[model samples]
Target: MPIGRADVSPPHWRKSSYSNGSGGACIEVADNLPHTIPVRDSKNPTRTPLLFTPDAWASFVTAVAIGRLAD
Candidate 1:
């Protein structure tokens, strides 16, 4: 379940709602991955994806949304 390598396959991909419409810098998430959540750079969809637990991903997303974690 280690999709951190240079060639990971995402079953699905979804861009963040906060992504710039013009496509500057954006991050995407691929869910429905059972116990894991796959994340990748939209700018490089063909590359490796960072995997995380569903809870962890949710926490991160919540934190980001609430401004608890700053970029």
Candidate 2:
């Protein structure tokens, strides 16, 4: 079941590992979707989520893991 924008009405969002318990900068990702990875700000879940292809999301995760996206 490929996920479309309209199909993401109720996503099961999970917080990023980088997120802290003190309500700091937090991002939530919904990978349960079939084809798309949905990302949203934990602080503002009602806002529209950003969608990414599974491959693109995997690449972004790899980059972040390898410090290629470090500040």
Candidate 3:
């Protein structure tokens, strides 16, 4: 689901630790909502965010943790 500014409540956005603070490849995630994980570009806060299901998000994170996404 696409999340517009008005579609979501106040989001507590957390930046990725891998972000070097160089204004490059930075993404923010808000997982406080039930059943959905919202992701947005850190540089473009005004834009709509992409929403992921909890299961999909967990699988993606697990793949990243195991370095399977690199292949």
lDDT of 2 by residue, 1-71 (tens): 43444454567889999889999889999988767799999999999999998899999999999999999
Candidate achieving the largest TM-score:
2
On residues 1-71, what C-alpha lDDT tens digit does candidate 3 reach at each position?
45553335677899988667789989999988876789999999879999898899999889988999884
For residue 7, give model 3's deviation from the true position in Å.
8.9
Rank all candidate structures by their lDDT, best first, as comma-separated numbers: 2, 3, 1
Model 1, span 1-71: residue lDDT tens: 45654434546888989889998779898886677788889999889989898889989999988999877
Screening candidate 2 with a backbone cut-off below 3 angstroms (N, C-alpha, C), the clashing residue pairs are: none
Error in Å for residue 35 of model 3: 1.4
Q: What is the Cα-based TM-score of model 3?
A: 0.80
Q: Give per-model TM-scores.
A: 0.78, 0.83, 0.80
Candidate lDDT values, in order:
0.82, 0.87, 0.84
Taking every candidate in turn, the Cα RMSD to the unseen true structure, in Å, is 4.8, 2.9, 4.6
True-vs-predicted CA distance for residue 25, candidate 1, Å: 2.0
Off by over 4 Å in 1: 1-10
- How many steric overlaps are in each model, in order? 0, 0, 0
